[model samples]
Target: MSSNKNKYCLFVVVIGFLTTNSAYAQNYKKLDSILKTANNEIYSNPDNVIKIGEKVVKQAENNVDYKIKGYKLISDGYSAKRNYEKSLEYLIKSSQLLNLSKDKLLKINIINKTGIQYHQLKVYDKAIQYLDQAEELIAEYPYKDSVHTELGKNYLVRGFIYKEKLSCAIAITYLDRGIVELMKVKDVANSSSKISIAVYNKGNCYLLMKNNKLALENFKKAATIAREINAKSLEAFALKGSAKVLFLEGNYKEALEALNKALSLSVGVNDLILNQEIYRGLAENYLALSQWSQFEIYQLKFLETQKLIKDTERTSVSESLGVKEAELKAKKIELSNKFYYLLLILILILILIVLFFYVLVKRKTNEIKIIKDKIYLLQNQKVKEL
Candidate 1:
């Protein structure tokens, strides 16, 4: 199969790079050891991730051409642990290291990483600016196929952020555009089937926009490609996205089936975040169908996701921004409370209007009854006199 050949070719390329660049191989060993230690420390005590990250940054500070990769590893570890500020700090250091990049290719790669850092910061403008620059620089240079793959990644990230922000319309457009660009370089895509998943995420963006027809077309393509590449996680991601589309389209039975398949696959991969989303979706669908038992069960499962990722501290106003989200969770909760209060007020006004009408009718009935009784008594007196 062409897909298999592609994989073989990518493997040869990477092996050739490794074999040719003994220096990179040597650096990989050192970085690998530090990565292991850093990961272990992070798992046992996440507070250490930030500290270790700081140490890594400090070690790189004096040397103008220090290994930016060390700080990046620390940042990723901290970000995974939900320590955003420290992660953010190291990300900045990684970007600053770009100044020492004598190699044009390295400069482009660092720009891409800086773009990512800005995106996480919710400075989408700066993120896009850096990404644009990276794209321009990539076109101007001669590097491995990985350079174009990185450009594709930047577009994918931008699309993802827009989708997360509920700018689904724009997200779909960008995702489609990114997929087109990636396909043009597919023969050279050499980025493995990461390109396939990038396309997979584009389908996901379309689903979020409620375009089931378009979403279905892309999701199927992504799944087949994933299968060809033996990438089960990406397949599950596509399955999950497709299931969501089915649920939104009122195809609950099929959606439930797809969700079950997705959850089974996602569980084996130990992706707690995806599991949380699956349970949440299941709960929503069950609630709509008035399946109270299933709703309650899945709602609990959704809430349990809070236990997997570390909860960030909330002290200083800015540092308390743990999730790198532009909006606070509390703000959403506050808005919901306001909406419910407004609804309550409307219900109370309706009740008062009904009570007023009932009192007026009762008073008129009493007045009419008294007058009728008086008139009947007067007529009886007149008949007695006759």
Candidate 2:
């Protein structure tokens, strides 16, 4: 009977162990689901994206990958909303978590993304810093196509940064290296587009150096590749480069035609950067043609558009911050509830341990008492016999 009772108690313990662990597994699955959902909707529904990210972050404990992924999701959402400060906060968290991961490629990719974000915020030096770090890391990697492609992007962005600083010679060198690397990427779709961008930037660098012949050649090559790949944005950008060359050559009529075509393409793609460039191109073309009224109109339009873009970005950032405060408060409460649940589980395990010990001690005591009774009866029998 005692043996049967012990077996039943052991079975209960096993069941409790499985139940507790199963709950933990289910909780982790839920957190993963929330993270995936947030990723899919990050740009389309930025507010909900952050809310889901916060949920995953709060629920995740001691899981490095989950925490890092959650932080990334939140950062991406903030970035899409133009909340660069908040986005940088979460990106920093993600980078810190990289210490817990063993994947070198993921680390490099995150570093690259950080560089791009800094570039968008116009922190040009910091952008170069991170991109430089990515390049250094990728150097140790074997010469795979993917690695080459990433290196191309790093060099391309760095070249643009140099261009902004008006170091045309240095920019051209970087752009040349970028184009070379991209050309090594085995004819993939992404590689094709990157090659177009790299070459286009190279053309701009050449233009800055007053080398119109080479600039025109590179721009035409970029446009041909962009058209073949159906990358309309890049095509528009390449066309603008060509138009700039035409403007510098004093072909105002031809420059106006190319600029008009690029303007329509830029508007169709809704690329604000390209649109700004188009407006500037039109303003310059008109100025060169001695059309003062047209020049003035386009120049004013460019300034107005620039202001509008800034205003829209600021409004998005402000709105995201307002939404985030409320969501963060809710997440804190949810995290508290999770802590309580963990505490409850610990208490239950402690109770189970105490019950196990009590049962063990009581069983030993009963056995000892039975042995003592046997000794007493044996002594009485011996005395009676004597």
Candidate 3:
């Protein structure tokens, strides 16, 4: 009866263990699906991305990978909203987890993303530092597809950095390199947006260089690719770029037409930068055509958008300071916990060592006592024999 009861208990324990493992597997799978959805909607529905990412982060528990991914997704959402400071905060959280993870690819991705955030913040040197780290890791990473993809992104950001620095000639080189790297991937659909971005940026560089012919060609190509992918914001930016070239070439009517189309497409995109550029472009074209009233309206709209951008930037900076303070507090608490844990482990080891010595000493004493007893007995027996 006892044996049967023991077997039953063992069976129950095994079943419980398997059930726990299965539950964990299911939870992780669900989180993966949620993350995929968040990524898919990151551009069009940034708020949804943040919401889904927060859910994943809350549910990740002790899963390092999922937690990091959730943080990254949140960062991406903030980036899409043009809240670079908030985006950097989440990315820093992801970076803090790197020590707990053995996944090099994850490290590479997080570092790259951090660099991109810095670039958006106009911290060019810091951005390059992080990108350099990612590039070094990519060199050692064995997966060809992932390496190519990440490298392509790295080059793209580099191009943007140079472009922002007003080095259009150097920027074009990096953008061209990025395009080539991105095209090396087998899944063209997955990389279409990135490729289009590279091409668009290249067009911008040519426009800055006053090479209208090449600029128009690249913008047209980028717009076609953006249309195919249904990337409305990209298409709008491309159209806006086309309008700029047309305006510079003394084609006011055509520029106005392109700007109107870009404006139509940008309605729901929430891309403030693109909207500002479009408005400014429209105003320029109207002024060129001697339409004072139309030009005044768009010029006012452009200034309003510009003011809105400044306000958003100020808010981001304020929130970033708050996030920094919170992170500092968190770090202090984590350090305190680690210190206590270390002290506890040291105390346990000391106690274990003391107990081990006590056991050894007690056994030695017992053996000595037994030997002494035998000696006394032998002496008594010999005396009796005498």
Each candidate's TM vs. the true structure? 0.56, 0.57, 0.77
Candidate 2 weakest ten by summed lDDT: 36-45
> lDDT of candidate 2 vs native?
0.80
Residue 176 in model 1: lDDT: 64
Summarize candidate 2's per-residue lDDT along 107-223 as a digit string, tens digits: 787888788777767767768888989988998876465688778879888888888876988888888888888888774565777788788888988887889999999999998
Pairs in steric clash, model 3: none
Better of 1 and 3 by lDDT: 3
lDDT of 1 by residue, 184-214 (tens): 6654323335466666777776666667798
Model 2, residue 155: C-alpha shift (Å): 2.1
**In lDDT terms, which candidate is top?**
3
Error of 2 at 150 (Å): 1.7
Pairs of residues clashing in candidate 1: none
Clashes of each: 0, 0, 0
Candidate 2 matches the true fold with a TM-score of: 0.57
Residue 190's lDDT within candidate 1 is 34
